[model samples]
Target: MAMLPVYILAGICLSYIILLLSLLYGWRNLKNNPRFVSPFETGFSIIIPFRNEQLHLPGLFDSLKNLKYPKNKFEILLINDSSEDDSEKLVQEFRKMHADLSIELLQNQRESISAKKDAIKVGIDKSRFEYIVTTDADCKVPENWLQGFDNYIESQDSDLIAAPVIFVEVHPEDPLFRKFDLIDFMSLQATTIGSFGLRKPFICNAANLCFKKKAFQVVGGYKQSGNYAGGDDVFLLQKFKEHKRKIDFVRSNNMIVTTSAQKDLRSFIQQRLRWAAKSAGYDDSFARFAALTVFLMNAALIIGLVLCLFDASYLQWLMIAFLIKFNLDFMLIYKAAVFFDRKASMRSYALSSIAYPLFSSGISLTSLFVGFKWKGRGYRK
Candidate 1:
């Protein structure tokens, strides 16, 4: 019946409105959080996991060398995941050059399918500090990154902290691919911060995540999460949530970790597919509902366009749907852009918006049947 599509469209619009309100509430809560800066007293163990990241290691080491925290209060643990490249040698060389820093190189003891989780566990097992922080080989940390966390933990009494991560334009003259990736990644980061505002935090990037060593041990330390290749951050967050542990999101410019965008479209799509695959493993009903609502909203727009081919009247509804979704999404992403201080990136939002529905729906469908390759390894749902 013609009314079926109308009803579905109504549902989609309502869902977007609910999502928008939730994000708005979350954004306000995030902004209201008083910025706290206290003396650095908590000792931290920073963990970097890698496989064939020889080229990126230099920049990471340079960033690590520039950290403003007291050298005695933190140690760097580089866990090599059996890299075929010179990643191990690079860490060793960097350690020798900075002998004054408490840096150590260790091999990833793989015992399951999730090599990254195994690598992180290995580092956590060897960590000597009270806190554990994880970042990627391709990421660069701010000088005040540790200081921000220290201040936050000291003030909030948090067991886990999720910080922001942004993608930097690799080329001075940005390509369309890079711009698209930036917008998409920003939307995710916005959702992350907003979810915390809503008090239903779900997603967090391991690239800038910190948690207490004792809390991790109490939560069983990724015993069953190793079944998935990804979600070292999100899955663990869920466990902490289940145990009613205290977690907070650190929303500060100095805490943001900058990472490189994928160089090519193939790599970009693969990365997204890997991320999407983790959704199948999410136990959080709110997260699942959010994801489904987003997918259906986008799918309706795509489907509405096709329906307009036969019935021109459907064009009116499609336009209304697009406008509603566009305005809501823009509001949320704009708040995130302000926080990241990359409002100039919004120039690409219009183009990225047009393409996102197709891209997201495609990734969702592909994730159902196709396995994705990450760091020379393949995984399936």
Candidate 2:
């Protein structure tokens, strides 16, 4: 009985220290990547893939109309990913409404299980410009989105550029569980951009990622990550990393693309699990290290929870366990929120701290057992 309490406390203490170190690492990167204010000027083909995205296009159209870049310098390419819905017609209708917007609607020819990747591949075929800026149909881009990309591309020689992606909460009354999920995603985006600033980092989001048309051809794009369900971001990131090619992370707030948070818990888990499954195939050591850090942090929390059940001696230990967990996570998420400009979500950090470890572990485990389904297709890891 005496040894039980000591063991639990020791485990929790160890977990806290690791998390604090991770947080410190994250905070240091945040400090290094101060925001830039200049506008982007590169002529780009903004390629967007959609499937049943009718609900979100109004906001996207508004953003498109609102962009500050010269209307002629950018063209919008919307690839209909074989949606049964009237997604194509909607884009066409919008095009007719705004004759000067330079919008083109293309049909997504299905070549694989993942509709998104194939849609992107098709978009590449249809693009007439040298530079490509890819964003999700659901995202609400900043007015200066293309201008930021153009400015950065001209000033920098990098073939690939990854931008910041942040989540916006539409429903204020959202449950803590949903908000909990958002906090985790915020830390991820923070680390992704920070890694670029820190040097030797491997993290990116497809929602707001961009690259030259030549870069995709050089790396072979989704060809490397085709067997898997997701990772249009990381797999391409690895290819760029291999060439020792220059890929810059656009940290400016103007470059930030706001996307919607998952509306419910079930869809959220499935989405995360699909992401975790790709970790097994990741070739980059930096991405693997980041993955390992998250895994170990969650593993430590799980062990502590398991001990709390039967060990009466865990009474004092549980108190220490949770305190260490909460504080360590707070440091990282706080920096993330500040960088992403969503500091209000930090209030959700408490529940996120408790749920994140288990949520991560569950996704990892689920990925191992069952193949996940997305857009009416199933894929095996």
Worst 10 residues of 1 by lDDT: 29-38
**Could you give candidate 1's per-residue lDDT for residues 239-328 as a string of tens digits?**
999899999998888788999888788999999999998998888988988899999999999999999998888888899999999999
For residue 148, what is the lDDT in candidate 1? 85
After superposing candidate 1, which stretches have Cα over 4 Å from the reference? 32-36, 170-172
How does model 2 score by TM-score?
Answer: 0.89
RMSD in Å for candidate 1, one decimal? Answer: 1.4
What Cα-based lDDT does every candidate model obtain? 0.90, 0.76
The regions of model 2 sitting more than 4 angstroms off are 1-23, 30-41, 170-172, 314-322
Candidate 1, residue 128: how far the Cα is off, in Å: 0.7
